[model samples]
Target: MSSKFKKRLKQLHGSREKRRRQSTQDEQSRVFTADDVEEQDLGIATSAVDAWRDHGADSRPTARGEAHFLVRHHPQSHQHGTKRLAEGAAVTLEGFRKQLNDARLHSADPSRLVFLDLETNGLSKTSFPFCIGIGVWEGSQFGVYHYFTPTEADEPASLSACAEILRDCEGLCTFNGSSFDVRMLQRRFSHYGIEHPLDDLAHLDLLHLARKLLPDRNGHKLSQLEEDVLGFGRTDDVPGAKIPGRWKQYLKTGSPHLLLDVFDHNRLDILSMVVLLPALAEGLGSSSDSARFKNRASKSDLGNRPSSSGSDQQARPPKAKPKTKLASQLSRTYALRKKAQSGGRRQPETRPTEQARQEDVPRETVKLAGSFSRAKLRRGMPIGTRLRELRGEVERLEREGRGDEERDEIVHRLHEMVALSPRNPFALERLVDYYRGTGDAALADHFAKRLDETSPF
Candidate 1:
């Protein structure tokens, strides 16, 4: 009986091993089939030389007989997502300078400003830029140009071409060029013993502007801004981290198939900057003008108000005006406050007119979480006001049983609310529940820990 039992256990073990081997074989076959499908879809080119030509890029020869890939797009015919490339020509640099409050851009010419973006292998000083995309406004048309180096030897020619394109431009506009792109390009030019064209240009880095304008935004990445501000969303764009590997693959296999997406990525970046500038300018202008108008109105009200007391009416002492910017602003604020307090008693509180009441009525309730205006939150409302509004919205959404439909956006609102007021247990509990519901164990743990730390005994 013991022998029979041992035999049965051995047979079970053997069957399990056999099934594992079969599953491994099946997985290997599936992997091979997926690879085959991918290869077939790529339509792999035969040689590097032919691959580039087939990729719709023309080659231009240099002094060392090396050539770089060149792809050009005419703004007259090219439309990047929803924005017409030609609309970039309509933007004025003077307006941008005034709106952005940058005196450096006072002399920046719109036609001479080049929109620049670079794709690099890595961030290290030793690493290099493989692709440079630039957009230039020429008359009524915007020109998009991409310079790609096929090999290390061809880098000089590509850099030279990029320099030539930028040499005539007076100003440079980039998303984060000040930190990465400009520095990288300068280092590359130094490495190649060539004169960098960026030295003389008036640089306008949009990253800083975006941060100032969209302060409440989660991130200021170009892709994020494209979605939030420009209403353009990228579909199936290659991840940036995977791009360097694709280039290495192209070098090894003589295929431009993968680099095709990289090229599109670079093009969209340049075009997005072109589309982003006007939007930035408009937003900045409106905000600045509104604040200025409010300040002026407050000062006017303070000035027109009658004296509150006999001493104020006498005005015997002549006071020196504030000399510093901060002092002047503070003085105005103090005067406004005094005027407000004095006038409150003088003017009787009257019932709201029909038009006033109608205006105060809550706006048509938006069903989706996406309708929450980030800009409105960023407009300098009191923290308590923002918290109340956010909490009220969350409560309303809960009452309506939004469930998974607006999960991500609801989470976003909670995050912003929590960021503004961390002590609030409501936001913390909701976040913990959200992460748990979404099966994000790490985030759930984090929020759970936070909830415990903040919980009252």
Candidate 2:
């Protein structure tokens, strides 16, 4: 019985080994069918071949055929095509003048602006363009072109094509292209011995205008700008840094799947540029109007309330009134404050009447006083004591009814106090309220601007 049991175990082991051998042989002998060949052709996995056959049998052949035909016929077309397009598409001298004229007349140019964006290998002088994307606006109709290095050896051709497109522009626009993009292009052209066309082009970089017009929010990224200004968003886009990896993947596997997303990202960048240009123009126009109105109002106020010794001076205007200097300084200060407050949840505060009249105190004196006030507060100084000191100083200034210089001196001191302890919003707000109460719009605006910057209302 023991012998029989041993024999039975040996037979089972033999059967198991046979089955394993058969499975290995079957896997090895698996036929390379048409599906496998097609999968190989499309750079798809063998397992995916079945799905392709099930769903894409008809479409695959047509796409493959077309791709092959295009590649075969235009062996060097991607490289040469770009160059041809650039040279062919360049705007003539006459065309440039015409577009500018149209822009002046209608506040818009009808030449169908081309928004250009490129993703490069890096941000250094040695960086080269791995791909280029262009979005052409032809009277509300949008066309996108994405050109990439066809082969490791075909970079020049691709770059040349890019140059051609950039050269033939009615109006060229970019986001931060002035500092980074255009400079990179110029370097690339020099390296490749190609003529840089962007040097002579009339281009507007949105970054400069953005810095000038928009509040200095942290969201200066192109993606952020697109979301905020253009009301557009993208998904499945490749991160800019991962572009090199995607290119390497395409080279290794001959799969352009990742490249498709890169193309989409580039196209979106161009479209965002298209949208941003007009929005920036509108912002600039609005800022210009506000500046003009402020200037006129400041001049009118100065004229109406001329100082006793300034009537004859006002008659001659003394080349220019000092009001312009005051107005300009106030405007700059206010603008800076407003920038700091943008996208923040703070409103400007009003100043107290007494503080407004106490504009004769020197800045150093107020700073020293505020420091003492803070130290005393920390040491359990009563709030009334602090208030009394400030009120006494303000009362003394009010009785004197000092000159403009004295008033400015007091305002300057208050500003220092506000700066040292932004938490003490009351002081800044009271100053603003005082300026408003005295009908000093510029001074009021100045405080208002500070409140905007630092207030947490």
Candidate 3:
């Protein structure tokens, strides 16, 4: 007989109806219900034009009779960056072919490649992609075109718009489109009975290559690389996990205001890949190229950036920054904050993760984190415990005549080790011998000084 008991009983089976609809159209007019909102067949016929009418100015129907919602960076006014993006894109295609182990991808021309990203409701048959972002070379410039679905009825239109534009391109590129985005599109197309043109197109999913290239990055999420390695972070951006909810909010309220955040989020994801792809491809070509890429990413030379988040921030993940011993970088981060505070603007809050990124040491740390550094090889082995292990990697390279860049990077690691354990003498003597062989008596003397400092003899 209690009201609380009755409410609990009402929610148990979702037997209570949320909304009622009168049919000027076929839509159920029902809002989200406990059982109805699950990603399954809603039994609503999405293909018919009679189901939905314009709710207001913000919600309208596209010419194709699909729901239309978020569109941004319209290619008409969007400009191409000054960098030779065509060359960069082509090189990126080659890198993809190398990593994906697929010869079929060669059919994709670098001159006509397209970058693709999608925001979807969920991964169920009824779940749909609400927004699609595609970046293509337009005339002399690279432009990004956005296609969005306004309602469940609009999903097909968004995909149709996307397919029509992409039909002309030689291939497609995505962050991790291989496993999720592309596959989802293909499935939806199959369900809709439309021919999926992308089926035969070449795809270069950067996610897989990112794993091979940035093993030090841990989980390999796009956001992590967006800050630490790419040196471009977002401000006031929506966390990716919340993206689906943003779309659902618009769906229920018919307000397009917050969708702008999704537009910005999609825009940045596309542009970052455009900028980052070439820098990464160039590294795959050679060791020197890798060194140069490290320098560019570390510096501000790779300039395409996203809006960074504001003062309300959380602690950044550990190992996000490169393991360098520079104290000056930390000092500079504080100086920038003090400057901001004095200017009357809210000072950007610094998290522990921000320190290394604020240091912005450069791409060499990214490259080092991957395969060519002593950091991964040096985990937890002390100078006393693993002098052999300490010298194992660099010694192999030296004996094989294989390490040109490896030698330069290893010497820094050796210096750190010798600093930590001068008494061991093994690392110090090797440094002296290595520096002397390389004809740097000044450097050799530096290690010898440590040796002398550590021992009386």
Cα-based RMSD of candidate 3: 20.8
Per-candidate clashes, comma-separated: 0, 14, 12
- Stretches of candidate 2 off by over 4 Å are 1-112, 138-140, 286-457
lDDT of 2 by residue, 1-457 (tens): 6999999999999999999999999999988799887767555443333432343221112211211101101111112211211321222323223333433223324244456677776667676776666666443245666555534444566667666666666556677777877787787777878875676666666676565555434436776555555445566677888987787776676555656677667766665555455444444345676454333323422444554445454521212435665466555555544553344424333333345348866443443322134566798887656555554555565577876544544554444344444434555776787668767687678667767877566
| TM-score rank order | 1, 3, 2
lDDT of 3 by residue, 114-135 (tens): 8898888877767778778788
What's the lDDT of the predicted structure labeled candidate 1?
0.69
Better of 2 and 3 by TM-score: 3
Candidate 1 residue-wise lDDT, 1-457, digit = tens: 6999999999999999999999999988874568787776445322455667766777666543445666665645566555666556566677657645677678777667889999888778798988888888776677677777766656888888777777787789999998999999999988888776687777878898777755544467888667555668789999888988888887787666767789889888888888777666655556776454333222322433444343344322323455875455345434432432353234212223445456675333322223335576688767788788878867876777775534544565676566666557898798788768756676677667767978776
Answer with 1 or 3, whichever has the higher TM-score: 1
Each candidate: what lDDT?
Answer: 0.69, 0.54, 0.62
How well does model 2 score by local distance difference test? 0.54
Local error of candidate 2 at residue 187 (angstroms): 1.5
Minimum summed lDDT over a 10-residue window in model 3 is located at 48-57
Model 1 residue 171 CA deviation (Å) reads 1.1
TM-score of each: 0.51, 0.41, 0.50
- Flag the better candidate by TM-score, 1 or 2: 1
Residue 2 error for model 1, in Å?
A: 45
